[model samples]
Target: MPGTTPDPRSPHRGRAVRGMFASIAPRYDRLNRLLSMGLDQRWRAALVRSLPELVPGQRVLDLCAGTGDVAQALHGALPSGTVLHASDFCEEMLKRTPAKFEPGAAPRLTVGDAMALPYADQGFQAISVAFGLRNIESPQVGLAEMARVLAPGGRLLILEFSRPERKIFSAFYRFYFFRILPLMGRLLSGSEIDAYRYLPESVWAFPSPAEIGREMEQVGLVVREQRRFLMGAVVLHVADRVAR
Candidate 1:
């Protein structure tokens, strides 16, 4: 039962997520679009939609910024004058970032660990980590870092793959996710971690909505709402840093 997967005691259980992405960064975007059938763009747009609630001209942070997809999406979705800071630990992953941002938007890209963000306390109005938080080796520290960096009343938006609630859809998702995805990943990325194998594995290992809500609340982030999409196979978790 070793590879069967241990229960998720913390959100920071795997580094394979990072290693897998870095290894396949060259073809990451293409394969993502192909595998998700282009719905990933709409998912990022849904993540972008969360931006309007924040005050106009607010400061934004995109953690685990991998190629700046969320950052670029936010730049287009938010009001003008939003200060955007995008950060990722992998140099190879970040190398593809600038090209994704708007022409001349000049997003600040930093090579830094998510657990130890190099920024002043309470510095950002909104922080987003799309499909990236579950990969951190120390998610408690990473979540704490997000909390530490958020200004009073700032929002933390999280986008992640989730288990569908309905039994029928869950069965269908498992078939596609487990049986089909790994084969497609091998054909596309040529990754060694069985990258697609790790995808469903990580999603299964990730905390449920209630579990994540409790963890965020423990860190003083109030669980605001959860927008479930794709029959709950994906979730957008919205939390707000409490105003002091």
Candidate 2:
């Protein structure tokens, strides 16, 4: 997002965010497990569980697939006839995904940006993003694009970090997030771009769950359910595109 043509709405300029992610791709998953105490995996599982039941041959898209965790999970959970596609803007991150799926059931992987997705209108029955929306330059536009690609009454699942609700817990979480996590991330990834620091900054700056629900509604998606985890440090939002 850092190096692209200047857009006032995006938080990271084009290339800057992408470059940071690319730099850390090797150790990203390891660092995530260490930092979140492996809760990240459970959070992802929660996202999968929150989805509406899918029929055979239905299509689903996992944006910001990030080494294919969500994609793999979706592939495993959905009916055998369902189709899953995993996409991300960072090729290095995409490259980190392993060839673990059965030959025929592997998800179709693509390198693409979220703000301007390459999909056609009403192409998918469900779209999901996990912990990646905050990294986008303009989340509002990203959400709109996601809604655009979903069929009428299609599901949208988002699992993202959020501010903690408790005062004492919030203070402690901030201390660890801002102070401790960055150092660990740097040691793990060996990147000098302060990538981990950006994590907290972005989460703090991003819209709250309520605000995000409103944003979804603005783009013709209605929030159907919301769930919080890890004492409100993370949230899952399930929305449905308005039927025509």
Candidate 3:
């Protein structure tokens, strides 16, 4: 995440990270659609449908809210007076989204760090991260920070790509992920970015669903449920921060 050479030790170099995302921000949406063949929207929809812990009028935070994908849909689900706070560290990426929100887009976009969210303890009723945890230096610290912002009995929904269970499918997916996806990303993004290449690699390197749930439990968040899809190639993990 530093310069063109990757530093294995710390992947989340703030300024450098911003430039990386900004470099690809323009083609981000188009590439997501083309590469995933529109499965990205399906994944976002699944996140919305699977999110059961957020009540109608509760305040919620969308961590690493890239271009208002989750935030826009989430705003529709909330009742009157419900608040949607979307934040990301990359200003250029955020700017790509409409500066003035669309009708019913109740989001308040802000530039903020995920590992150190700008909110008091128990400030939100629900917190969610979609396709963002892998970018963090310490996902545990980010998760703990999210839990810290949740109110009593609040829940967290994390949607992320995972390692596929089927060997053959995993191999094929790997081919598409490592080879095809990155090729298309480079072609469309018009830059020599290895971000898409890292996507598949990171998914393979990331902890399994059970491991993530255990991490949540360790952080004092009770893991209530988990749903894995595409032979475990993707997972939506849910947990709660109960009142002490």
Task: Quote each prediction's TM-score.
Answer: 0.91, 0.94, 0.91
lDDT (Cα, 0-100) at 4 in candidate 3: 53
lDDT of 1 by residue, 203-229 (tens): 897789888888888899988889999
Query: What TM-score quantifies how close candidate 1 is to the native fold?
Result: 0.91
lDDT of 2 by residue, 22-122 (tens): 87777788888888999988999999987777888888999999888888777778986888888999998986665657766678888999999999999
Number of the top candidate by lDDT? 2
Candidate 1 lDDT = 0.82
Clashes of each: 0, 9, 0
Compared with the true structure, model 2 gives a TM-score of 0.94
User: What do the candidate models score in CA lDDT, each in turn?
Assistant: 0.82, 0.85, 0.78
User: What ranges in model 1 sit over 4 Å off?
Assistant: 1-16, 52-57
For model 3, how does the per-residue alpha-carbon lDDT over 49-139 read when each residue is reduced to its tens digit?
A: 7555555567888888887778876766666677888899888777655544665554777889888988898989878899888777788
RMSD of 1: 3.6
Q: Ten-residue segment with the worst summed lDDT in candidate 2?
A: 1-10
